[model samples]
Target: MSLQVQIMDEIKTAMRAKDTVALEALRAIKSEMLLAATASGSKEELTADDEVKLLQRLVKTRKESARIFTEQNRPDLAEPELAQVAVIEKFLPAQLSEEEVEAVVAKIIAETGASGIASMGKVMGLASAQLGGTAEGKTISAIVKKLLV
Candidate 1:
């Protein structure tokens, strides 16, 4: 099944299981996916890649909210955001470890014959396309910078 469909199933399961935290998170994901589909002029269906990107965006947002809440000494609020982050992460591809990301970065650098910071853009474009849902953008960028510099 597609990610959105899986999410919908899980949402139903969560509701039946009385998992408020999971239910809330799944509902928010459904809402975001619907919004993305509508925004893209697609007929209410999110493509796989689009679903991954949307889930990643939601996770990123929740992480930031959790960080801010923690910084403000509000663990009560932060916990829910962290829970949502976990839920959203279930839809993302298995994340690449730092070593794996570095290896991919190295391959891209060699493949593109990219040298120094000047070629950073070219390397980033290639690596991001290759890594896509498997890796976080900031992590990929940092690895690319470390390799290129």
Candidate 2:
């Protein structure tokens, strides 16, 4: 099933199961999808890649919020945000492990003939495209930097 359709179905299930965290997370996904579809100059429908990017953005936002809440010693607030992260993560592709990411970055560095930190941008551009939804950009960049140096 398409991500949007699958999300809608899950929303129904969450509602029936009275899963507040899942329900809230699913609703947020639905809302983001709607906004993307209707945004000025955007296509009426989102591609699968677009959906993955959207989900990643949502997860990243939640993670950052959770981090901030934790820093402030607000476990009560952070808990739901982290719960939402877990729920949203179900839709994302299985993330690459750090080792796996490092391997991929190493390969990209070789492919691009990247010499050192000066070629960081070149390596990053290629690595980001190659890894895409499989790994986070920050992780990929860190690996690239380590490999380059």
In candidate 2, which residue pairs get closer than 3 Å at backbone N, Cα or C atoms, i.e. clash? none
If candidate 2 were superposed on the true structure by all CA atoms, what would the RMSD be?
0.7
Q: What is the lDDT, from 0 to 100, of the residue 66 in candidate 2?
A: 95
Candidate 2 TM-score, true structure as reference: 0.97
Model 1 per-residue lDDT tens digits across residues 15-104: 999999999999999998878878855766667788888889889999999999999999999999999888778878899999999999
| Per-residue lDDT value at 5 in model 2 | 89
Using all chains and alpha carbons, the TM-scores for the candidates as numbered come to 0.95, 0.97
Task: Estimate the Cα RMSD of every predicted model relative to the unseen true structure.
Answer: 1.2, 0.7
Alpha-carbon runs more than 4 Å astray in model 1: none
Tens digit of per-residue lDDT, candidate 2, span 91-145? 9999999999998888877777889899999989988888889999989888888
Q: Cα deviation in Å at residue 144, candidate 1?
A: 0.4
